[model samples]
Target: MSHSVEVYAPQNWTVEQWNFVVWSEGAPSNTFGRSYATADWLLTQTAVRPLVGIVCGSGLGGLADLLKDQVAFNYRDIPNFPQSTVHGHAGRLVFGTLKGRPCVCMQGRFHLYEGYPIQKITLPMRIFKLMGVETVILTNAAGGLNQDYKVGDIMIIKDHLNMPGFAGNNPLAGPNDERFGVRFPCMSDAYDRELQQLAVDVGTELGYRDFLREGVYCVLGGPSFETIAECRMLHKLGADAVGMSTVHEVIVARHCGMRVFALSLITNQAVMDYDSEEKANHEEVLQTGKQRAEQLERLVSTMVTRIEYNNNYS
Candidate 1:
């Protein structure tokens, strides 16, 4: 049975006749039913049983190579899945072992700015839930909004400011599917506290002291970078990091009762007041991500190792 959700479009959206598209067929069994089914089907063909799911951020697909014996599946092969179209996104899922733990990772991700609905953007995490992913590590490339943060630093997501989804446009806006979660899921400490500590511990152990930071992440709808005014406003709003992804995935993962930990790679500084001739762009973001890719890889590998060890020994 397909679930129909009631969506409220913003007043500005009415001029464009932006209405919620009702899906009537092949609806997810639960909120995460379809993707879970697809992922489970894929996992059955492989020997690995994933303990966690990881999503690679823009220009960060290369991180999947760190996994051993990867079984890759294109997004097109999955039923009810959205294809990734961004330049940095690879549109494939890699199932393998990362740091000796069974893991499945997305080499790319769909964005709301890519014309995909919020539900489609978060569908993969639902699949992760079905695949028995008890925890999720979401990584994204973002422009730095905090004054103290520098490019190439990794920021652990402690909380989020979901300005887009809460404004009547949400992946969970439609009908409440009780199988996935309750109608009103609480957002307090949505990012698991213990998991956050584990990430921090790993970062500290690896001697990435100054390069690692933790703060609130703010998500925005964007194919374009934010303006100076917007960046300053976000900073004033208590956001330590700003990005275009992660928030939706975090919400879906949390709704499915999975533990979530998100990290943001600071690609560029949103320096609106700078008088120098520097600016933030996609090329710059990708280059910075590439330069810091090894750091991110090590950080993630260490964190995963810790999670598996603690979960197994405890």
Candidate 2:
């Protein structure tokens, strides 16, 4: 269905109408200026000049607790920030130090299924860019598509298949902002190879090699678990894990010239067989994330200490 022409005019809409567009569909007004304004607001609340940014996914909010001397803001307190309604999400932006390296963390993340437009959901990435973050580490709880992967495994994202991007719901779909990046940004190296290697090294040192795997993550618009056929197809199409968030934020972060590294905690195994009695649910996802939260934190925080020295974008 197509929207009426009047919907394009954000200025004339009521606060409720404008919000519905941004929070539900999308806004033509999600421009560079708006991102800059929000970044300016956040800059004042924290004394730290964070060079690293981390996004905590699902039940992984414990990662934020690792930060020392934190200054946090509720999403509702920030201009242009969307509130997170997901149960596992804490809906806060925190600025603090991680092992003495200045960093910022998102205790929660926005999602396509959370009534947010693609751009609105990825707004934090742009805010991260404007706040002077050079490297971004993202973690998510996902369903495992690779049969070799078990529940509680950690899959380092070497690449991803943006299922929503294929349908033209990409966060960077609208007007181009040259200040942030080129109109046609190359996604071929979206996940920084060096960072991927570093994560492996860290995980190995921490004796997490057994549960650590690497593969492409496929992101679908969710809130609904995939059918058996869909899971089979996605796995055959090269997805090791499947999820709803992270990919858009990765795209936005990369577009803004940040070095990116991401990983997924395989919360549940995707049921690819019709006869299987197993099921996928948020409770399972959150529970798995809770179980693996500590090791995930150790892996990321260890990488953060070495990121500045090893992070070469070239």
Among all candidates shown, the one with the greatest lDDT:
2
Clashing pairs in 1: 5-174, 5-175, 35-127, 36-127
> How does residue 119 of candidate 2 score in lDDT?
85
RMSD of each: 8.2, 7.2
Q: Residue 277 in model 2: shift from native, Å?
A: 0.8
* Tens-digit lDDT string for candidate 2 (80-106): 889999999999899999999989999
| Poorest stretch of ten by lDDT in candidate 1 | 1-10
* Superposition error at 172 for model 2 (Å): 0.9
TM-score of each: 0.87, 0.90
Give lDDT: candidate 1, residue 241.
Answer: 82
